[model samples]
Target: MGLTLQFIPYLEIEGLSSIGRIRKLLNAVKENKIVLLEGRLRKEEETELIKTTMEEINSEFKGIELAVIYPESQNMAFFRKAKQHFINMLLGDRQGLTIVGPASVVKEIKKDPNKIQLFTTDVKVKAKRPSKKKKNKG
Candidate 1:
């Protein structure tokens, strides 16, 4: 099986409803495509996405692993933090990256303040050999 990575820009999902966004992300993940979204989803939307994924979990569709990476604000100065918050509010979009991938394919996702590491599992497929037939002439 081949792996596919799908990139979704903020504008593509900016105007979508909460459910619409979740559906889009979930659909991509279900198809074994890792989705790299430009911006992060709201807390409520994230919760809803998990809920929907849980409901759809089955044998083929194991689930999903989601991660969000953003600049660390804990060590930032008060003024700088304020400015970041202001910018996010003004743009109505969080300055971050969101990754969503199927649990079957994505083994793990590790993140720190500076970078993200995604680990994937290799899927093994068996190829069938064609049968050989022998013809007899009398």
Candidate 2:
């Protein structure tokens, strides 16, 4: 089966921010059998919201997987500490994954890529492992 991914953009304080988006996203994940979350949480409140949401989801769907993406340039100490708490709260008994990249990269992806697409004929490709061949002996 293909990997199921749920995208949650960074939280903003304005109306209909990422936190609300996350609640809907999580519900969709539960319904669609999503196994991964590719998104960002910019604020401490966002993190707390995630923890609470995960707990709520877990009560119904135990061992649900979550994959989060964050910026690498963030304060490592703070991220590390928060990550520990996040894991213990949301992922302690469940299998999950996390990825880190530059903030710019995440921002770029979070933006509307259609505005920058060079070609309309671009085709998306799926990742695959290279095949190995046997060597011949002389």
Best by TM-score: 1
Candidate 1 residue-wise lDDT, 1-138, digit = tens: 678999999888888999999999998998889999998988899999999999999889999999998767899999999998898777756578899999999999998777789999866768787877767768
TM-score of every prediction relative to native: 0.82, 0.34
Predicted candidate 2 versus true structure: per-residue lDDT over 1-138, tens digit per residue: 333344333222123455664555555555543423333344564465558555764444532333344344344698786776686466331222232221211222232312221111223578787877778879
**Model-by-model lDDT, in order?**
0.89, 0.41
> What's the number of clashes in each of the models?
0, 0
Clashing pairs in model 2, backbone N/Cα/C closer than 3 A: none
Colliding pairs, model 1: none
Model 1 RMSD, rounded to 1 decimal:
4.5
Q: Tally clashes: model 2.
A: 0
- Reference-based lDDT, residue 105, model 1: 93
Error of 2 at 123 (Å): 30
